[model samples]
Target: MRKWGPLFAVSLAAFMLLIDITIVIVALPDMASDLGSSYTDLQWVMDAYALALAAVLLGAGALADRVGRKRVFIQGTVLFTAASALCAFAPNTATLVAARALQGLGGAAMFATTLALLGLAYEGRDRGIAFGVWGAVSGAAAAVGPVLGGVLTEHIGWEAIFFINLPIGLLAIAMAARLISESYGDREARIDVPGMVAFTAGAGLLTYGLIRAGGHGWGDGLAVGVLVGAAVALAAFVVVERRTAKPMLDLGLFRRASFVGIMAGGLFTQFAAFSGFPQVSVWLQSVLGYGPVKSGLVLLPMAATAFVVAGAGGPVMARIPPRYPIGGGIVCVGVGALLLTMVDAGSDWPVLVPGLVVIGVGIGLSMPPMSAAAYASVPPEKSGVAGGALNTFRQLGFALGIAVVGVVFRAAVENSIDGTPAAGRDAH
Candidate 1:
């Protein structure tokens, strides 16, 4: 229990931040209505948080390693809590978007150090259990976020969602400060400012292009330029890291198959979840006409399956090679996603349940072990960098997933419209 305190504390903060990711998604409509927003405003609200997180995560991780994880975590808690308050009180769309970016900055600091803290706090088997527990908390947060947001938005208004983070963040900060021991990364590591700059800018460009292109149209000159610029910047980042004496991110981590596989798993996990859930919510509300409460309740099986499997799977993970849980998880996701294609426009709960549960279970199985694998692949001194890398891949996966699905869905819609008369197509 003593060893678990920091892990739980960090997990609490992570859960709060991740929940904020999907939570705001559910409140998009309410926020748009209240702010008298155009489509662009809503996109900015969502994109701001993600982009900011991606922009700073590697830097935040490197900073945490140098400065001390506990110190970074405590500071992040304060910043995130304050940002949440700002978001809650924002008078309009612009203010809310700005506040969310601030929240992401805080979140990045907190997230970057979590696994590092866990790795230091526990050893071997205990570390495995800690990852499992952390993964369970993350799974639960992601699973419940949309429903919680819906309930809050339906009853308490959109501001309530952001306001809800205040207490959680404060509690996490207090607990983390008290329980987590201080730790630093490599003792002799120097700040690699150029590498950090290139990596951040490169990742930021790629992520923003993937996200913005979904809505702005793929052919948009800015999006194309952003994508091209991302490629160039990332190439430069590689060059800088290879030549620099002290690099923020070591390029060698990718050499290990375990590390690469874990990264791939993380990406695939987010790809499946984001590709399915938010879009399905639209179908549920717009097509099936389910209320917020009902729609939320309907997702309970998916959430619960993840929670249960993750908690139980820890011991199992300790006994087996990580490949089973991680690979099996992806396979489950693939199969689940395929099953979801059977969901006709007129489909009901029975059609949705199988796909959701399977995907949830896959996420449950994969995330915990994948986390452990990534952490295990690196030296303790590099936990911060490894964590940042893992999350960056997952974030990229989320954006790519949304973009691919959006493109496919749009094509389908266009095809359907093409079948209609020219007048009807023009009306649409």
Candidate 2:
């Protein structure tokens, strides 16, 4: 366990950051009431974080390589913890939204470096186990978000959701400083400023348009223009990456199908995660009237199962080709999503548990192996940038998943209410 210190530090830090990604879902209802936010505003509360993370992660990773991963990682902890405080005391929705964006910026820095830290600490079979453990912790944290969020939001108010981060972030920061040794990805890697600017504009604009279009109708001219502008900027970014001698994103990673597939797996896994969890939470609280604790308990099976399955996947991965286990895991998640679609307004906990378990199992199986493979594909010197590259896709997928869920939810509700009485709509 002594040798596990740095791993524990990185994992704990990651857990705190990952928890924030989904925790706000359960708190949204309370925030809506307190802040007088519309559905779009509530979606922004989620999107703002994802957008900022996606925008800056590539640069953050490169910065880690140029300077030191531990230095950037510690800085991220300070910024994230401070931003959480800002969020807790936010006076209004706009303040909360801005704070969330800052939190994401901090999270991007940590997210960019944690995997690199893990890689530095472990090797060969040990690296595999570390990834399994990391995946389990991350999967469990994400799965548990709504339940924790529900408990906090229900009892202490929505602000408590942000407040909950205070102790965790501070403790993680302290532990990381003491236990984790400093490392660099590449001392020679210069910050690619122009590449950073192009990717940030491209990713941020596109995601904003998607979030808006999901909450509002696609007919909005602003969404259309933003999307088009984003496309043009991303095209420009590709040109910049190809031309820059030391790019923020190594455009060359796309040359390998295996690496691209591993990254795609990250994208799909996050897409599955965000799209399903928050939507289900909305169904549980708003449609079914289950309280936070009870709803959380109902969702516990998935988290528990996922944690176990992820730990187990390491052994299975040792014997099989990595792709097989990863593919199998994604397939399990899809099956779970299918089962969850059968849920109705009056469905009980028994009806929900099976699907959650299946998805949990799938997440456990896929995330570890895919992550391991992603790290292995790049040279160790590029670890921070590589991790960032993979996560950029993951967070972008997360943002898109939320938008898709919002669109589906809105459309479904509109259709459900089209012919209903006003009282029935209110009751619904």
Identify the leading candidate in terms of lDDT.
2
Over the stretch 1-428, how does candidate 2's per-residue lDDT look in tens digits? 55888878888888888888888887876788889987667778888898888888877888898899999999998899999999999999999999999999999999999888988888878888888899899889887888898888778888988888899888888888888888876587667888888888988888788777777757778878988999998999999988988777777889999998988888887887657676676666665666665566678888899899988777568556889989998888888877887887556557877788898998999888877887788888888888888888888778777667777787664433233422222222
Worst 10 residues of 2 by lDDT: 419-428
Write down the RMSD of all candidates, one decimal each.
4.3, 2.9
Q: What is the Cα-based TM-score of model 1?
A: 0.93
lDDT, candidate 2, at 303:
85
Q: Can you give the TM-score per candidate against the true fold?
A: 0.93, 0.93
Per residue, candidate 1 scores C-alpha lDDT tens digits across 245-305 of 8788878877877788888888888888765565666555545556565666677777788
